[model samples]
Target chain A: MNHNLFPGFIGLSAALFAIGAVGVLVRRNPIVVFMCIELMLNAGNLALIAFGRFTHTMDGQVFALIVITVAASEVVVGLALITGVFRSGRGLDVDELSEMRE
Target chain B: MSVIFGLAAAVAVVAALGVVVAQRTLYSALALVANMVALAVLFLTLDAQFLAAVQIIVYAGAVMVLFVFIIALLSPGAQERLHPLEARVLIGGLAAVAFTVVVARLTLNGVSVAASGRFYGRLGPFAPVLVDRHGQVQTLGEQLFTTFLLPFELSSLLLLVAAVGAVYLSRRRRAS
Candidate 1:
């Protein structure tokens, strides 16, 4: 009970963020990429809650709540865009979305 | 207490890895759900009861359901494999390592436990584990409504806009 869980929490957040970043870079599937983005957001959420607890304030929690709200909206827009892309019959692989490669 | 935190963190990390490593989008989505649930437990360990509930309800429950629904709608295609020596993979691995090192170093060195010890441990160990069954929620509601009212309202407007945009984007165009 006297132990410090802060360090562990921070490290875990870092690991999760790193995993998500790698997923974003390596994955070609748009849906997988979107999931990785969500993973990164969750990592951020964990860090905010951990910091809030260690600091003993409601600021972090409120911010985390706002983040969750934003993330939900972001997902809605992202999924819609993905749906639009699917309708175009161009496939879901991000590598194939090179219209702006120039 | 430490055991609980350690177990939850381990499960969370492994599940997050699953989210990244799973080939199928559905499996990755499932892994993400596990990760979110594990994180909610971790939040509980941190005494953030309200946040834990929100994490479960919003991320694990709603957001994940949307992800799974989208994955099903997208339909499956040929899997893309990453070669070990490919430039993109190598670059991404290097970036990930660098980011992890920088973030962990900042966390260990920049933030000190002793500094926040006073505020963090104001309440003694016996300190009412629940922190007042309704106290946490009350505090959250007060701050959310008073100090953070603007952001809260803005977020609602944003959500409304996002919903409308999603519907517009997904709707089929009528033939002229």
Candidate 2:
């Protein structure tokens, strides 16, 4: 097995996920962290597809498709919420919003 | 065996690096998208056509975009903070590297998959199930409609409930 493309892809996806996770853990900015989370999700998508192909199953592909659709809808609604948060909180920093929970 | 694994390993590391190093959410999002696409290709090579498509449609397409859109909408001046993470990034990154090695070793230890991604031309062993039969989608639909209709319908209802809950959460809070 000399550099098979499938595992290569999986490896790349995993790398992306790791980076995203690091960003989430280390970044102070909420927006940046949010984006990193998305990056992680995408990485998982890649893994799913690779698994699907290897297993000769359509389930992974179908799940990926559904994920995409849900992502789109979520973005629309999420953005709206974010905008509202920004308006109220007056800043985009995650640490600043810690007060709202109480 | 080592060669193929190495390639996969290298790609994964690089893409992961890109996600961490990218300055903007858009860039990160793009990197993630690339990662997802690569996974899809990997899946295709593995002969998991169904999973590959779902990966594209569901995870890559839907989930990623939502993430991107949220960042775009909510993230204000996030780039300014990127430099801040640089302070302790070196120490943290080293740990990440160690983690990767351990996980990679584990993966290598478990599965001695065939050298080629495409071990079998078709699905089944020996001759493959080549019974066209309108493909997996059609058959899945038949199965769901006939045998697993209730679970399928319940899933839809659950999704609907989730949507409603999200709307409620986002609604403006009433002032006392």
Candidate 3:
């Protein structure tokens, strides 16, 4: 197909990013908030790949790969922290973890 | 093609909403899985065959399994409800809208400029014809290993650090 769907794909990416932002803002569960972060990262990857296709370059794809790698590492460390916090008898609500805010 | 793209995009948007709105954490995880699959389809439509595969394998496969496993391990109960008109929700919704508008405008303008032949960044050698001829994975792999080799190797090191950190963080605390 020779259709130019770049703009549409970008719009979709933007919408997804926005949804993820809202989720991150409003969700109390740390895991759900983490998932929203993943959603936002995936939206970024979509835009990267779309730009790659539009420009006939592989740089975007390579960058997206690196992004995926970083995201995976982030998830590992983040979940471990969450697990540790839960094991320490603290609740999982992000709003409740306000030790630093005092 | 447009029809399929539209379908996938719709699925992605709805699944994203599901992730945000699902009361149960497990349900939110499942909704994220659906969203990942829909994004893979979008990657395919964008002619990023290799990215589509990676999206499924890494995101939908490995990452999501990890998410579900953690959810199962912790079994964090349903999140406490927040009213639709809650101050937090209203503020977050408004911020998200403003962010979307700003980002969409910037992206649309950049894309239009690039499309209209005003952007002069030198296009890479891997044109669509060359990519199709050399195979998507092969071409992407070549560039990744060649031009992006340093970042690629560093990412491995980063993963190693993350693994060690996770193991240390999750390990049982010894009696002081």
Strongest candidate by DockQ: 3
**Decreasing DockQ order of the candidates:** 3, 1, 2
lDDT of 1 by residue, A3-102 (tens): 3567778888988899898998889888889889988998998889777776656777889999999999999999999999888889888888999985
Task: Indicate the docking level reached by candidate 2.
Answer: acceptable
Tens-digit lDDT track of model 1 for B1-176: 88888898889888977877787778888999999999899888877888999999998899999988888877665666667698987898788878878887877764465556654557432233544655888878888999999999999999999999999999998868
Winner by DockQ between candidate 2 and candidate 1: 1
Per-model TM values vs. the true structure:
0.90, 0.66, 0.94
What local lDDT score does residue B93 receive in model 2, on the 0 to 100 scale? 68
Full-model lDDT for every candidate? 0.83, 0.59, 0.90
Output the lDDT of residue B31, model 2.
69
TM match of model 3 to true structure: 0.94
Worst 10 residues of 1 chain B by lDDT: B123-132
Specify the highest-lDDT model's number: 3
Best by TM-score: 3
What candidate 1 gets wrong by more than 4 Å, as runs, is: A1-3, B111-134
Put the candidates in TM-score order, highest first: 3, 1, 2
> Which candidate do you rate higher for TM-score, 2 or 3?
3
Candidate 2: tens digits of C-alpha lDDT, residues B1-176: 44544554455456656666677657766766676665565554544455567767765777676766666666665574355346567656666666556655554543444434345334631111431445655644554576566655655665676577568657787777
